[model samples]
Target: MRLFEDNIHIEIPGRSTPSARSPEAEPSLDGKVNSVSRREAVEAFLRLRLFMPERQKRIVATCMNGEERQYFFDKMVEIAATVEGMPVTYQQDGNGDETIAHLHYFLGDCHWYITEKDREGEVEQAFGYAILHGDLINAEYGYIPITELVDTGVGAELDFHFKPTPMAQIKQALEDRYG
Candidate 1:
């Protein structure tokens, strides 16, 4: 995977450098490609999670971040500290379901969630949400299903998926609650 930070490209295994005109690329100085910062990438990623349906976001995230859930939470803490000016503290809530998983973040009395609705193949769906003061503030919701583990010449692989949420809705919610 190739990650671009400020037009500097860092290539990961199995990822190639995209051409300047690639959809994921942006022309930078002398035809170099620029990419968003890690914080920006993380924010975009979290925002996108709200729109995914059920386990779709879970699958995509598994693919991108591998099986270590801590990586995802670590990034969230980074965002909370740097962008939200919140402490690096969080609490979680979920039902004890393997096929369906919910990762919740309680920050500053607000709740945020990235959830997978189907893990054992009952259904496939995933989403992200935020609530403040007992009111639903922002959400990204979508549904897609992956019935089985994918094998890419390695061991069993988990699926992580996500979709884009409305920026205006999220922005307004944050401004009202945190501003």
Candidate 2:
């Protein structure tokens, strides 16, 4: 197998702070929905469980910073430690289903995800996401599918498949020319 390195940094659009929900003092970044707070923007984004458009259903994007990113990362490490390469899928409502065969990565970052309604015989409706840490001011800022990212990374070590070969073939082909 030929191994290659990818350092594809994505250019995400900056989300300007939207108007506050109520008429009062403008909330600080930390207090806003996009804030690092548990009830902030990150949570809201997680709720919809968006799938990248059909054109790039395999792609996804998430952002966070300050305590939020760190907290998420640390929690990921802990959750990963307990899992034994179980096939898992996360839901917007915090529910997840486990399967016996699949690929994934950990501590992983997603700048964007391209979605695909089907992945081989998996029949999954969605497929990729990119984790990002913008807002240089904050030390932590990212959005990643904890299970997918973590499992993909530890896949081989735990005796399971990482990313699907078909997907990798496409990704590698893109990288060879212009991923």
Candidate 3:
């Protein structure tokens, strides 16, 4: 097992904790219960209600503390519901794949995710571009804390794919609840 740090991959030989999903569902190519499958990734995102507007949610499941995971998911949903609604243009870099971004209203945090694939078209690595950490502050509405996500490459920028007709209602609900 290994923990990949900021742009650096480190290897460690040891037993890893079990995944949140079932082992029957997350099998590896070599018949090992090792890496998270794409299906598991999507399931994790959906279960957490995380949103990635530009790219499809194809991230691997990662182990994170409850606070960090909540921060990331909370930000993801808020961004999808508010600022960037569906039918929005998907922004891609020169390689023709989309680059995703999201805004967190809690502390006005925004993040940009850039995913790079390998020669076999499998996800090789992912990096965050506009990774901003929000500071805890008092706003006109209420308390706002700086937000942060787990450092693992498990997070994705969920897109707002629903109809715009119901967006206004959703945004109002968020403002009302979070305020």
In candidate 2 the C-alpha lDDT for residue 157 amounts to 19
**What would the per-residue lDDT of candidate 2 be over residues 1-179, giving only the tens digit for each residue?**
11223634344365333331322223444654222333443343343232112211112122222212434433333323323233233322122111121333222222323222232323233343332342112212123333343234232111122333333453444356432
Query: Per-residue lDDT for 34-135 in model 3, tens only?
Result: 444344434445543423321233332342222123333433344433432322222223422233322321113433332221122222222223334421
lDDT of 1 by residue, 1-179 (tens): 31222555556574445442333344444656444443554564575443333354455456334322334444444433332321111221232222122343333454444344333323233343545554543433333222222111222222222122343444465668666
Task: Assess every candidate by TM-score.
Answer: 0.21, 0.19, 0.21
TM-score rank order:
3, 1, 2
* C-alpha lDDT values of all predictions: 0.38, 0.30, 0.32
RMSD to the true structure for each prediction, in A, is: 15.3, 17.6, 15.1
TM-score of 1: 0.21
lDDT of 2: 0.30
Which candidate's lDDT is highest?
A: 1
- Count of clashing residue pairs in every prediction: 26, 40, 8
Runs of candidate 1 exceeding 4 Å displacement: 1-31, 66-179
